[model samples]
Target: MSLTAFLHSRHGRGFSCRAEIEAHHAAAFRRFRARVMPRSPFYRGMADLPLKALPRMDKARLMANFSAINTCGIDHDAAMQVAIRAETSRDFRPLIGKVSVGLSTGTSGQRGLFLATPRERRLWAAIMLGCYWPELWRRQRVAFFMRADNALYRSLSNPLVRFAFFDLLSPFEDHLARLADLDPSVLIAPARILAMLAERQAAGGLALSPRRVISVAETLSPEDAALIERAFGTRVHQVYQATEGVLAMTCRLGHLHLNERWLRIDRDVIDAASGAFCPVIHDFTRESLPILNYRLDDVLIPDPDPCPCGCASQRIARIEGREDDVLWWPSVTGPRMVASEAIRTAIACLPQPLRDYRVVQQGRMLHLWLDAAAPGAEPALRTSLAGLARRLGAEPPALVFHRGLPPETDAKRRRIRVLPEARTGV
Candidate 1:
């Protein structure tokens, strides 16, 4: 199964055309209707219903109906207790039978609970190892940096592979010595953490060679990717995963293609003009915990052009952060979801060599933070943004500028975010 799934990920291996993809979906759903749907209490009598007819699910709704939705008879409250204990104690060894329970960091409001059976764990390991594993012949070390650890991740361990878990809760500096000793052949971490390590490498404070560097969990920006490449002298690969599942993964050509082998994604287009939308995923692979008609808050911009890698799955140009991260400015068409790239371009074209920045919108005010080479950056950024607003046919918000960047934390770094819901109508 591992080898087959691994081969399926390669271009022209799993899905060659739209028709083939549709056929795979048809078969998978057929199996689900016959074998899987009957077991789920939440979806008990809904086997004959089409996907659209099924209840639309989000994190909140899933959690509310967790006990009934899951095929396994695991109680939601019992699973939550186990997950919380493991998190607080920093011990990932515990499990409920063969099923592994873990918590989501919840960049959104409430923390989410996820469960995976042994079969699920093996499949996950197969896809990850098959795609990102550096060398199979020789024993290689894998450095996995995550907010929390779980048996779900431990499936990657074997005699030929030494999986090292780097807890994000600990000080970043303290892990340097261990990292040096491990000198892992495959390095995986959040985008910011990878960038931080890249910075260290550039500064000559760290010296280690890795065959693969994978950015996981959070959004990996173009600038940061370039920085990582320059520092490591290797192309940076990305794994677009959420608690929902491994939604997408970068191909050999470095283009992100939705994991259509395991998932059926339906885009809920938020902005018709920009073609940005959140993914409503139906993962036929996840049976222990069914994730059907589930909408994730992430907003992804689609790439219309075909990938050279030849994977017929949907191509993601970039993840434009969460829905809350999108700022809706007043436009002729009412509240328009402003293209974040436009704002980034405005700041990028600035004459100053700005190192970093943050943009957060609160009510009618746009708070801009600049870590620039010169104090003159504030006025320059303001003018650029005003021009952008004019070009987009939108009204410029009150620009409140601040010098320097926000303090670094373990939290996922979101470049642009909307603090409150914007008034859509004038």
Candidate 2:
């Protein structure tokens, strides 16, 4: 069967049944193992282990064995070169055939590429449509915002859905103009940008009202989440997608539901004391670059209770921050890094006015990039920000003021960046 036909048939199937889901996953896993083991030099080396005995893998190991991990036909360096070329171009679609790649914008300090086979992409489309917008299965209009690149754009398009790509590189005014014409029913964008759009909608500058406002790319801080919710007058749904693949998504009740049917999560607990698990996923949905027990950098605290939304799927809190987002306590004489979730927690606690900002650490100093609504709001921001920094341990670092936060060329806003300099004056 064609990937799309087979996948579209699987929607809302008894796959949601735990017993059935487990059986399907086991069968899929075995099939994937059979396909990749003999052909992939990387998988071949580890083929001695029964599927149950292979050690869970991490990113470092993946990178180390990248050449061997992929299916026999793919050339890793060639694929990367194509991805880079696709990322740099302006066409509405990319050149990769039977291969789908989407770039990720996160402060993980690594450029992530989500690779999928034709089959995986088809399945992803089905599930995304089934859970997030069942209406789309019939024909609908979608307005999506992201850094403009043909490859990324191609992935978001479908014959059943009319999609208009909003380039973050374009001025907000331009988006408002085009959106007024597109009149799409759903708006999916980065959390901060969506919040900005919501503000414009409130100001009467933008006229389109989307039935759903989906937030992606960045972690939606609670304060920002409430702001978008209030500004748009719609429940903001969260989508957890990375260059790796679709990680999890928010259900109607605002609980994060993992896409476990396609990907199995073998979680590693970061704070074993608190029972907080970070994900190490085995994605059987795709074979081109099947992700087997691949550890990811995100840190999340799983939700223990069943979601009030009534979906039996596994759910968890939004990723709090990357493992490396921890603030390092400055030491007068020794290795300076120390355990502190202060940066993530402090930023989350900041009042609504400071909607978009970034914190950078250079040795002993903390630098904040502020993008507030009011022009003179810097004074209020200065006070609260410096206070937060001090509470994080550095006495008080230098604060830099800018009219707007700079979006990286790739269109990502880094929330926390670690500087190379050993120290910076407080």
Candidate 3:
């Protein structure tokens, strides 16, 4: 990657208005489309076709037609083998030649393999630093805690930027010790892990003052965000990313703005009343694996007001979890899909705040998992959930409460999920 080009693209020009940002996105998309149409078999006949007219692609489709979808002639099975090896051995450095392979945690019901060239990795690093790090040139220490490590993530580590990765699968005590020693200026982790660290910070178990705390890989609840902010005396910023790419990051004004300069997004509005939509993304920065109009399952709420930061990029009000996480129940007429926000609101109305919790629906059974920290809070939780069911005008499923729920082996936490078998109709 050209350092000059990366710096110029990120910092040289500014979008004074939304029109200018849209124009930039249009140009980028055109360039990307022109480049990929002839090279990718999947897009071979889509030269002059409109984006909407093109068949929408999803995780399963992408994986099934991986070779045809990707411009690089990497075999899907070979890439999957490399990704699996990295996951089993916890070593993410082995590349398919120059291409880096990383595996998704399969939280969305299917595992995904992401490939990126060395240049693409550098560009990604630049974009991340440009968006999140205010003092880009200043020497700083960064602590990134996640389920898996990747060569792409390690590319950001340098003499000036001290980057350390803490594996979530490791013992909690081990992470605490390492965190205290590293004393990172920028701390990034899943919302749940950040909350745990905040509890330790409040109790004086950990002694570090990170300038910026970024939440990723999990939903950031308002309760958890407030606690983290109070503990660190800093706002808990967010990075909305997945195995596909870095989709958005919080601006200086704390609004999560889509990376429109590098990505073209087509919103598939699900709820017009609530300004909620699912994003169909086309990432122009990725070369090895071309992501064109790939629709994600996650739902996003758009901000009505403009961001104060003066960047005309589209701003997301909030991430409302995945469509799959929405619980389905039998209704008088048809299957009733319960929104995640309603469930979250019901849980938040409890008398006591839960340290961590998850709601899973399986075959007319609702399994509630609460951390041991919130003792005796289950009664209130149950009451609130029952109230939600009553308000929805549906029969409440059997509720099963499990105290002291253990964390998953991976860092990706699904606070709300619906089992595949139970997903069939009301």
Query: How does residue 92 of candidate 2 score in lDDT?
Result: 36
Error of 2 at 30 (Å): 2.4
Task: Point to the candidate with the largest lDDT.
Answer: 1
1 or 2: which has the higher lDDT? Answer: 1
What are the per-residue Cα lDDT tens digits for candidate 2 across 1-426? 344533532343323456666776788788777766767777776755655467666655655565677673656566667667766664435546666555544554555445566656566656656555636346667888887444334444677777788887778777787788887777889887887887787788877767778888777766567877887677888888766667888766667887776677767776654456678787776566657777777777777777776555677765766666544454353233323345555545545455566667766566666666455556665676567645544445555656566656323444666655633332
Model 3, 373-411: lDDT tens per residue?
455587787787777777766777888988767467434
lDDT of every model, 2 decimals:
0.87, 0.64, 0.80
Q: Which numbered prediction scores highest in TM-score against the true structure?
A: 1
> Residue 397 of model 2: what lDDT?
50
Worst 10 residues of 1 by lDDT: 417-426
Model 3, poorest ten-residue lDDT window? 5-14
Q: What is the full ranking by TM-score, best candidate first?
A: 1, 3, 2
